[model samples]
Target: MKEFNNKELEIVKYIKEYLPFREKHIISTRELSIEIAEKYNIDTEKTSIAALCHDLGKRYKDDEMRKIIFDNDNIEYPKHITGALLHARVSSIIAEKEFNITDKEILNAIESHTVGHANMSMLEKIIYAADYLEPTRKLETAERIREKIFIDFDKAFLEVVLESITFVLSKNQYLSDKTIELYNSLVVN
Candidate 1:
């Protein structure tokens, strides 16, 4: 097991408390996130913390998530925000309010992990890719993206966002405008 500082340990403990069943997934995400961060010369500690807390709001009910989203004036709810997408925003809020995570990059990564934004920072891109390509996913597409990450990160990110959009559409879920913006931004640039 990797050693965590006091704050990281506390976040891990909170994750265990709130999302006990997702421990393996969280660990895998943290490890992959750290690897990507190290490769890109980003902050591994921040990546680790964001990955650990990325799903913190998953345990909340849809109504609870809505309440949190509406109550926090700082959160700007997307036009087509649905229950599936609410967790990302709520997780960022929890990370900020409950965990005292004040870093904008970390918070944005957590918020955009599920549905990416128009212009993602390297940190956000890493978390989004790591969350989807974590070892436990067992999807061949994930493996392909994982392989692509080292060779061409932007291409990998574009593929991940495309995959996410396809998945949501296949499920007949409400696709957020932000995701479309992300796709357009990547393809247009």
Candidate 2:
């Protein structure tokens, strides 16, 4: 059992009560992110904090997400996104405004963990990878990522992003422009 900061503890309590179904996912992400950060010589505290709160917005309904996104003028909400992806933006807002998170890197990690960006910080990479590789998530792509995670962070991240894109396409689901931008940024030379 990790001792969370006051704010982290609050977020944890909220998650436990609101998203009991995903309690394991949150903890798994936090632990895996901390491990990845330590392995890559990044800050463990920041990684842990970011991972712990990454999915905070998942507790909200679609209507609540719309309000949160509308209120956070700073966040550029996509023209359209599935209710599932909207949680990432809402989580980032709550992480800072409600949880008193002041670290830009940690906030960025939380924001970009879902759809990675052009030039992600090391902490961002760790959080994004850990979110996908968390133990609660049992995808074949996750196993492949685990095999390469300790070996190459960039490669593993790219694989996860590609896998996500492929999954979205296979389902004939709505794809965010950010995902395409991320893919171009990472893969297009």
Candidate 3:
């Protein structure tokens, strides 16, 4: 378990209340966030908060998460994106409305952790890396990325994005336009 400031503790309490079953995973992300933030000299508090709240929407049933997307007029829930990914958008919303997180970086990190986005900030990249490299993730590639993270953040991030796209293709699932857009922007730019 990682130590949290009083403010971060509030966020943790909120997460625990919403995601009791996912405590182990959530804590793992938080600890990873702290490690990444410290290595990068970024704000660990914000990174931890973003990581803690990243999967809050996963607590909802698939149908419920879809309802959240359906109910939001601003979000265009394409049929291509799965319910598992939809939780990122919903979790960002919950982080703001339910947890009163005003930081856009934290919100964007939470929203973009699943599919990622173009032109990610340092904080966003840290949370994304932490989410992907958390200790519980058994993927051998995760260890590779973890090793490369300190040496070269962007390269590792690009690899993570590519791997996720590959996984989706392997499953014969539709890839979101946002994911494609992110890949193109990163690779071409």
Q: Which has the greatest TM-score?
A: 1
Residue 34, candidate 3: Cα error in Å is 2.0
| Candidate 1 clashing pairs, residues 3+ apart or interchain | none
Tens-digit lDDT track for model 2 on 38-100? 788998889888998889888888778987888776455554675678888788888888878
What lDDT score belongs to each candidate, Candidate 1 first?
0.88, 0.83, 0.82
Candidate number that wins on lDDT, 2 or 3: 2
Q: Stretches of candidate 2 above 4 Å error?
A: 74-79
Q: Report the error of model 3 at residue 58, Å.
A: 0.6
Q: If scored against the real structure, what TM-score would every candidate get?
A: 0.93, 0.90, 0.90
Winner on TM-score between 1 and 2 is: 1
lDDT of 1 by residue, 149-168 (tens): 98899888888888888998
Clashes of each: 0, 0, 0
lDDT of candidate 3 over 121-188, digit per residue (tens): 88887877788787787789998888888888789888988888998899998777778988888889
Regions more than 4 Å wrong, model 3? 72-76
Candidate 2 clashing pairs? none
Which portions of model 1 miss their true places by more than 4 Å?
74-80
- For lDDT, the strongest prediction is 1
